[model samples]
Target: MSKIKIVTDSIANLTDEEIKVYDVHIVNLNVLVDGVSYIDSDEKIAKETFYQVLKEAKELPKTSQPSIGTFLDVYDSFEDGTEIISIHVASSLSGTASAAQQAGDLSKNHVTVIDSEFADRGQAYQVIEAAKLAQAGASKEEILEKIKDVKEKTTLYISVFSLDNLVRGGRVSRAKGLLSNLLNVKVIFEFKDGVLTPMQKGRGSKSIQKFLDEQVYPKLETLTVKECSLSYVCLTEFLHEQIDKLKSMFQEQVLHIGFTVPTVCIHTGEGAFAMMYYHD
Candidate 1:
């Protein structure tokens, strides 16, 4: 009988303990700053240094998905009869999933690729579920079904205080970014269907806090939340308050708080934070 192995991209934001406990293989993406290319994995770079470099850079750092050759090397490393389940970030977010799929097609071993339709901890939720099911000797179909369930139940939201980085990345027009900065505009986004949809647009940090009080906490109380992850570029005063509230609501034991992926930082800029939940 062939055993199953799990593969995922760097954007999952999985901790070292979880990666080791689950024996997950990570293929990392790259961020090119000036002429230097840095691997965007926790194993490769320190979070403080990565965020600092992003802040100091004169222009937007260019990011690239892992090459197909990298995925092929990982898949081919496994012996024959090994079942490989390659899970990755949303296809709309990056080309990592596409590269994995291309490698799956070319590899001699059997490889199954899945796009989690999410990123950061949201993607991590699905990847971890797949690893757990694989370890229990579950069939591919069973693993797929559970992954589908997790995807349906998991949710991600981001709060941004500025649009400077988005304008630098050409994702937002300079005029809008400038106007937002002058007006102190804040935006909340819901990551749904592999796209970041603007859920609320209001002025100042109070709008962000109001949204959390009136929107997020009430909803979580009604559901059984399995786990929650907090990702941010900086720990602002607002984030500290939110953290206290989260601990009060869900208990600190169930929370994993850390820096988000570098790609996420590049777009959201400083004073941006994300909340991801995996609920029943």
Candidate 2:
């Protein structure tokens, strides 16, 4: 039987337990702040500390995809004849997928690269599924087909309380950010076809919840939800409250919570929350 290995990037938002259980290999991205660089790993800089620093920083940090050399190093670490399935965040979101492809072309071992077309937990779902299938002694073709099916069924919804980070990162204009703050407007975005597009805007948290209830829940009812995960930049009473509500609502589905990665935080800022679900 041929050995299969699962590879993903830090943006997957996988937990330590999940990483250990699945034996997933992660390649870290470079986060530059105040002219200093840090790896996007818990060992290098904790997520809590990163958020605190981001809250105080004068300018938003810049993130760079892992180098092809980094990918090559990981690919070369495994023994010969090992088959690799390298899953990554959306190509439209980052160049990590392209870097993986470049390294795969240069690798000696058999390598298959996949663009998850999602980020955070949405991407993690595909990685975990592929890892599980590989661990079960499934063939490479079977695992790849499962991943492709999951990618097609995944849905990502994100809501941000503040647009400061987006404005600083140039994703949103300063004037619009200020206006949103003044009006207490919360904007929800949906990741579709590998692009993050604005879905709706509400006046406040209450209105946001109303939007979710009216728009999101109905759509979810139409699909056969298999798995769901929630991720947030910071933990708050509101977050806990929402989680409790979701847990009660989706009792049959697998539900989990995770902290957002630094790269995502750099764009959404604090008080950002996202819900990702996979369905058929």
Candidate 3:
């Protein structure tokens, strides 16, 4: 057994093999689509079904974080001597972090709760790394140090193709958002300081591509990114082009691509894609 155990929420977007190989534990978040609930597993069938149902639904899908009792249950399951690092999605985005912290306090084990301040693959970067270090017998201090280093080096950028969801989620004004959607306005955001700060907006998907071409590609060209992922609510022709372009940048590692979680889709709407990468 590893010296330390790893725990994270379903928002991390980890693969089944990644979880099995690294021995990471997950707490699920419930996503309700048209009154039917589905636990996020980052699986293809769930994503396909969810999105298809999403397209015809009259209301936006709702997502809820795991309860504090759930976290306490997982924490108490570990032996008293077991050290756990519980990493979760951004507190700014969900209450999962608070729940973990509350549970960590109540648990008898030594639990270190961390707010990853990211979603999907961004949070997975931290969870996976900590799991790796623990598996290799690294101390808690060393794992925490490495996690902090990676957090600082990480960058998450996103493009929203429609403003409808944001409007529905109350992130944007309904009238203005509806107008923007009708006009085909695309917005690009950089997730920084635990917030999705808008970087640029213009008409058409070209704006998204241009922003990436100018703002992100140069950085990728210079940095040694250990992980790269492109997560999306819906894939388009433009997304395929971006995927091909990003694949060209990585010499050895494969670019990780998957669906963005409901926490993000609530804000980005359909056809939104996020780019996340971190340097050493």
Candidate 3: global Cα-lDDT? 0.85
Poorly placed runs, candidate 2 (over 4 Å): 170-183, 218-224, 251-253
- In model 1, the runs with Cα more than 4 Å from the true position are 42-44, 170-178
Candidate 1 residue lDDT tens string, 143-218: 9999999999998998888898877776567997898889888988899878877777778888888888889889
Question: Model 3: per-residue lDDT, tens digit, 1-280?
Answer: 8859999998898888999999999999887767777676645326544556577777788888888999999999988889999999998888999999999999999999999988888899999999999999999999999889888988998788888887777666799788887887898888875787889888988888888898889989898789889998888899999888988888546589877766566667778888999888
What's the residue-level lDDT of 131 in candidate 3? 95
Relative to the true structure, candidate 1 reaches a TM of: 0.94
lDDT of candidate 1?
Answer: 0.86
Q: What RMSD, rounded to one decimal, does every model reach?
A: 1.8, 2.2, 1.9
Judge candidate 2 at residue 64 and give its lDDT. 92
True-vs-predicted CA distance for residue 48, candidate 1, Å: 2.9
Better of 1 and 2 by TM-score: 1
Give the per-residue Cα lDDT of candidate 1 at 14.
Answer: 88
Model 2's alpha-carbon lDDT is 0.87
Model 2 per-residue lDDT tens digits across residues 112-135 = 999999999999999999999988
* Top model number, TM-score: 1
